[model samples]
Target: MGKQMFSKPPIQKSHELLLPTTKESCWILVFLLAFGVSSIHGDDGKIDFRYHHYLDLSRVLNDTAASCHEISRVYSVGKSVEGRDLWVIEFSDNPGVHEPGEPEFRYVGNMHGNEAVGREILVYLVQYLCSGYQAGDARIRRLIDQTRIHIMPSMNPDGFERAATLGPDSPRTSTSWGSYGRLNSERIDLNRNFPDMLPVWLLQEESQRRNHHVEIPEWYWDTLVAPETLSVILWSLSQPFVLAGSLHGGSVVVSYPFDSCGLRKVMRSYSEAPDDALFRKLAKVYVDGHRKMGKCGQVEPCNARNFTCKGGMTNGAEWYCVPGGMQDFSYLVTNCLEMTFELSCDKYPGEDELQTYWEDNKEALLSYMEAVHTGIKGFVRDGSGKGVANATISVEGVDHDVTTGELNIFDIKTYFLIPQRLTETTGDCSFRGLTG
Candidate 1:
């Protein structure tokens, strides 16, 4: 089929908050005025359900690093359109420095600011990993020692503030940004604002190859890659990331790549990746760790009648298309295999239900990081048992390959490094290091 103009579905209305059905009062949201708020917190001074506003989140990051400078480092990778710093907390013994042969993984939260659960969970992750390390937890220590993991709690801080500022019972906007803060400052959906791969795939010829970024025309300059998107794009490219999964709200399932088919929207279809099996394994590791995310039989399937994602994992396009999604862009452009995690059914869950979320997802969060070690990762030696630095590693029949670093070790996600055989003798290897 020829290229079709992408007219995606309208934004969902489920993000609006509902009033509590209490006997004392029906929980009427009395908005005295939208403009006058002493602070972003609730009347009690904190949005308790473990949720923190932008200021508090930043404070938590600083405090975490302040308390544990030995194993943690806090820095801003980029800022939002509204000039909010995109804070990233890296957890490692050698936090700021990148060691060769060590693979990196990242978890990004609050891509949609209204989806507050992910943002809160990611903030909590900093405390969980850091305090766990201090407590001499073997698992936490092992993870920190082995992987260079980063948690970006709020990629869209401006949107978060906007969402929190609006509060509940506010009228929804239809044109661009949702009722709350779903989009960035300019009201563009960040998830739908990337250099879409489907167009590049169809346009690129074998002789004139171009990357997802390089292939874009001048017409797509401002809208295609927003400041927030560019911030994450550059930050992600700077690291040798093996995996980068984002936490989104509005559903409860693990969604893998190919978010858009690059064609007109259809009711149902599946879009498989070159490394579908590896993606499945990675998603399963996460879903299985969650107490309820993996069980697909009766009580909680992704969609009871129409679908059955055996292990609570769905291909992004098959489930529903999200054009210009970060997941697809990360995979198609770089070595990182990005996945989209729909963490909750409610875009903005109430505060009282926050602890339940932490308990539900904490184990899954830790286990997903362990997946970076699932594929063949270790040192590559030569014939005489010497470390072979910069040697290309390829498996027969696989299109991609990874090279060993100065440390003589190569670590790669199986998503792109799908090797059927053991040696690089059969074919030429193209992917040298997961670094951009």
Candidate 2:
């Protein structure tokens, strides 16, 4: 029993203190307490925490699948200028929705890079749905069961990386105009660069003519090719029964069709026909959702019953005639119902206030989701059989509305469509829905 090293504490010290007299003695007490707690608590594991960021988000998505074994897939639509993969994570009980002929509900975020909360919200939404489903939450389960959600967390990864690396304090007035951190190398506003080019240009030119000045940035004319912008347009065009929205930041608002020149006459001039009932319904959905968010001040009445038209830049199917853009292209080529959602107030709200924004907008966001679930859409055509230009279209059930532009149509329901213009090339058009 050589030295019986460390076999016991000093007898004299133990007697003096009436307690553990050595470091080894203290270890035993700590271990015992830990074991006792474990025994009592049965070792509940750590709670998973989620945050915004592509890699971290992907890991969370992977962890979620491993933990719950739910149905989900991370698919790439195209490559960014930096060669980063632009991903769309699909979540649904039925992954089969990706199969040919199935409908899709698209929710995209971070198109401008500076507005990153949508990425987090989208990721959180997935986690919420999956966790809720596992926990037997009926509403969550039903939504997943009925709808296929396609979430593109960061549409402009190149720009997003630039923004993240430069930090938040970087001046917005920096001379570097075409960096991936701000806009594409071409410097075109991705939000304004959809395929509906003609209507957009017309509106832009009209605005300049009215003001008797040219304020359009030089960069707008410099970059003609937008890969990131093109990919989203192409992806939307490929989908069926698609009700899609592009999420942006700055003034909190929900804007629908006729984004191009925002005049009633401009809209009417472009749309071969008019569809008042449909326009009113779609506007109502947006109006109702905005009211719930405490954003009553920003919700403007659209060009429908008791609604008034407010002029703004034309984008989407209602304003432009183009070959690209998520909404315009989707409406022109795929016949999907699409809209753009501006989330959060200007200057990007602080992280602490993000929850409030979410709470206010969640119902409105879900209304869009609900619209997709119900498969509600409408179409407008001109007299010439070519899809009409600047026509107002709406969905009766959800109160969603959009104006259609040259060679484009509007989808009220899932935002999917067949290519057909109004029979009249230059005059008013007619539209009908399930109601009215």
Candidate 3:
């Protein structure tokens, strides 16, 4: 039970058929009304301000590393668009080294500068884990000992600093001009800037077979490669991450992939991921922790317009289609299962509200991190008990099968760093394709 830090660096699916009808669609309509009202409706400036500016956050993280030197280290993954170093705080028995049979977990916060709730919680999370370990908490000791945990408290520093409604160059927010502050500095919505998952041709120059299609008027996206998004993509690629989540705001729900609805459609649509059952359990951990997230009634959403995210979860696109989102990109291109957590109803909660928000979410955060260990993992061995190298590992209900790597341990795309957890009750006897 201990803690340390280095320089600076940075770092779901479920199958269900609950189609939206005209009646259920009312939630969407009421939500739009509530959202619009919330935009204009301020908290009477009664809220205080206590969030960290970019430099202050750096100092805090650096201090944490200096204190927990043994169990922690600080390093820089990459820089932001405006050249601010994207610092990462690592907590593990051994930081920066890949351990066999160990799963890597990551939490990214404040992808949207204005949506500051996530960034704040992540800051607390680092301290929470560090302090717990120092206090000799067994849970903290086991988590850091068994898994690699990476936390990026602020992914969009520039956007947070911008203090504007939208990206300066964005036409979408040209007239609205309030405090949307949702896009990155270049004015592109980072959430909507990742490579789209819908099967369609990019610019004619890019073919179907190419791995990265980054050359669009905006690279098949409306915005070019904002440095923040690029930094995250590279960091995830460099690790053997199995489970990840990003913190967001403006809603109080946990959204799982695919963020897009295959193609562009205005209304709600359905797209089930390969591992729908697995994803559901992962989300339920958080929703169940925060019973309010799964509840709808007095003061909360009983219908579409006012905090109406039923059961506290929904498919990203089914709520509404958003192409090129980060959640979908993580699953389609990497060995990670990432979910976007809309932590609070307010994109940026006031200073006094920060602690209360943390109280509500801290348990869910800790639980979700622990949930990574609940999934299935083991070597696929032979009759003589010899290791089986390069053996195919397939799950029947799931779309893709994984192939074993060097140790013949059915590692899947792990060599390439491709992704989850298996539970005893739910995971037992699952995946029919472990063949001869």
TM-score leader: 1
**Distance from true position, residue 303, model 1, in Å?**
5.5
Q: Global lDDT of each model?
A: 0.64, 0.47, 0.62
> Per-candidate RMSD vs. true structure?
15.4, 24.9, 12.4
Worst 10 residues of 2 by lDDT: 25-34
Model 1 per-residue lDDT tens digits across residues 1-436: 1111223311112211111111111111111111111111112112234668888998999998888899899999877887788999998879897765567889999888788889988887788777777777787888889788999999888788888775532223342247468887777788988767765654563446522222233444534356777678667555657777799876788889778876556644787666666677677777777767856564354345322245677888887787788887777655677898888766666777877887778778887886665543444344445544334444333333343334212423111222122222222223224321
Instruction: Give the RMSD in angstroms, all C-alphas superposed, for model 3.
Output: 12.4
Model 3, range 1-436, lDDT digits (tens) per residue?
0111212222200101111011110000000000000011111121222577888889878888877877888888877767887878999988867665667799998777777888888888787777777777777788889878999988878777764333323223433223355666567677876667554322321453432212112333333667777667667555656789999876788888777877446457766776565666677777766636777663355346444446788888778887878877767655477898888766655577887877677778877887766535555344444444434444444553343334223433222122242322221112322111
Q: Whole-model lDDT for model 1 versus the true structure?
A: 0.64
lDDT of 2 by residue, 36-118 (tens): 00001111122232335557766766676565556666778887766767777776776635432234678888777666656
For every model shown, what is its TM-score relative to the native structure?
A: 0.76, 0.59, 0.73
Assess the local accuracy of residue 52 in candidate 2 as a C-alpha lDDT between 0 and 100: 54
